[model samples]
Target: MYSTRSSKILFFHITIISLFSFSIVKPIQAEPYGMAGCGLGSMVPVWKNDIGQVLAATTNVSFSSQTFGITSGTSNCTNDGIVKQKMAQEVFIAYNEGPLELETTKGSGERIRAMASLLGCPTHANELGKLMKEKHSYLFAKSNLENEFRSKEILVRLKSQIALDDSLKYICKN
Candidate 1:
C-alpha cells in the first residue's frame, strides 16, 4: 500500500518525464522500417513526439489531445526517419550515376550540411562545411563539371560517414 504523499510524488515524477520527453523524443529511432511497409505516419516516433498531430478525423464534435500530429489523414506522411533513408539513397545513386559533383562551394553544400544535421550527423555536417570552404576556379562551361565533381565527392564522403557514425545508422541503416 502506498501513502497519499508517495502517490503524489510518483505522479509528479511521471508528469515531469512526460513533459520533458517531448522535447527530445524526436532524436529517438523512427520506425525500424522506412515508410514503405509501416502502418502509418501516426505510428512514427518522430511524428508523435517532434510534431503534434491528430491521429484520426472526426465528424462529430469532440475535443481530443494527442502528441505529434495535427491532421487526421497524415498518417502516411514521410517522417524524419524516412527522410534520412531517402537522403542516403539519393546520395548512393548520385555517387554511382557520376553527374557526381555537388557544387559544394554554393548553396547546395549548405543544404547537404543541413540535411546531415537533421539526420543526426553533426560530424558529417562539419566535414561538409570544410569541403565547401575549399576554393577553386570554375571555367565558363567546365565550371559545371568541376562543381559536380566536388559535390559527388562530398556525397560519397557522407555515405562513408553514415557507415561509421552510430547516430547516423538509425536513419541510414545499411
Candidate 2:
C-alpha cells in the first residue's frame, strides 16, 4: 500500500545496498605457489636448486656436473647445507651459462622451449628464462624448484586449486 514515490525510493535504496555489498564480497584467491609448498627457512635453497635444474636441463648438462647433493638414502634435499650449496650452483649456472646455451647449444631440455615456440608461447618460455636470469624472492613462483618440475598431473591439480587456467586441455589429450 505504498505510493509510487515511496516505491521508487525503496527500490533505489535496495539497489544501492546490493551494489555496496557486492563490492565488499570479493572472491578469495588462492595463495601463490611460492608461498604454498615452502617456508621462509626453506625458500632460498629450494629456489636455488630449482633454478639450477632448469639451467642444467637447458644446457644439456648433467645435474651431477654441477655438484648438487644427491644422497643415496633419499630423493629429497634433506640437509640444509646441501640445499644451500645446490642453490649456489644453480645461481652460477643461471647467471654464467644460460645465455651461452641459448646462443650456441643443443640440449634435451631445450625441447621445452622448442615446444613452446611451436605453440607460439615463446613469451611463457621467456618468462621462465628470466626467472633463471634474475634474483630469487618469495614471490618468485617459477624458481620454486620442486613444484615447477612436478609431474603434469600434479601440476594440473595444483594450478586448478589456485584457479590458474583451470582448463583441462593439456591433460586429456591422448
Candidate 3:
C-alpha cells in the first residue's frame, strides 16, 4: 500500500545500508574465493560477477559440493592447516623484516615475541630470541638476496635451527 515516492526511498535506504555493511567487512586472507565462497564453484571462471556468483552458489548448494570439498580436502580446500600457518609466518616475516632483524640481533623485542607466537611457542619467546641471537650471522647471511627471497631464506634457516635444538624441536609447531 506504499506510494511510489516512499517505496523508492525505502529501496534507496536498503541499498545504502547493504553497501555500508559490505564495506565494513574485512576481506578473507589468502583465500581468494569471491562471493560464492570456496568450493568447486569458486574454481569456475565465471564467478567474478554477481550473476556468476548466484550460479556458483547454486552449483555449490545443489551438489553439496562445498561440504564435500571441505570434509575431504578437495576442490580448493586443504586439510593441512600448517600450510596456512606457514604462509602467515612468511607474510609476517616479510612485512616486519627490519624489526625482526633488529630483535634477532638484540635477542628480544615485541617483534621477536610475535614471531615466537607465530611459530607456536608463545611462552618461549625469550628462548627463541636467544637462539636467533646466537645464529644471527647464519640467519641474516642471505641479506644480499632480494627482500622476499631474504625473508624466505631466513625462515628456512630459523626452522632448520629450531629443528636442531632439542628444546625448540619439541616445543615449536612450525
The candidate maximizing TM-score is 3
- Cα deviation of 87 in candidate 3 (Å)? 0.7
TM-score of each: 0.26, 0.18, 0.54
Which runs of model 3 end up more than 4 angstroms from their true locations?
1-83
Candidate achieving higher TM-score, 1 or 3: 3
- In model 3, where is the ten-residue run with the lowest total lDDT? 79-88
Clashes of 3: 0
Q: What TM-score does candidate 3 reach?
A: 0.54
Which lDDT tens digits does candidate 1 get at residues 1-174?
Answer: 999999999999999999998877766454443323223433445434322233322211122211111112133434445434444444333332322135444424544454555345545665543433332122111324454464445445555655564545565433
Ranking by lDDT: 3, 1, 2
Expressed as tens digits, the lDDT of each residue in 1-174 for candidate 2 is 999999999999999999999999979753322321222322234344566445434332333322222222132323355344333333333433334234223222453243233233444544433332331221223443443232232223323332332232342221
Which of 2 and 3 is ahead in lDDT? Answer: 3
Overall lDDT per candidate, in order of appearance:
0.42, 0.36, 0.80
Q: Over the stretch 37-151, how does candidate 3's per-residue lDDT look in tens digits?
A: 6567878875768898898888877776765555456777564772366765775677678878888899999888878887889999999999999999998785578877777
lDDT of 2: 0.36
Regions more than 4 Å wrong, model 1: 1-75, 80-103, 106-110, 122-126, 132-154, 161-174
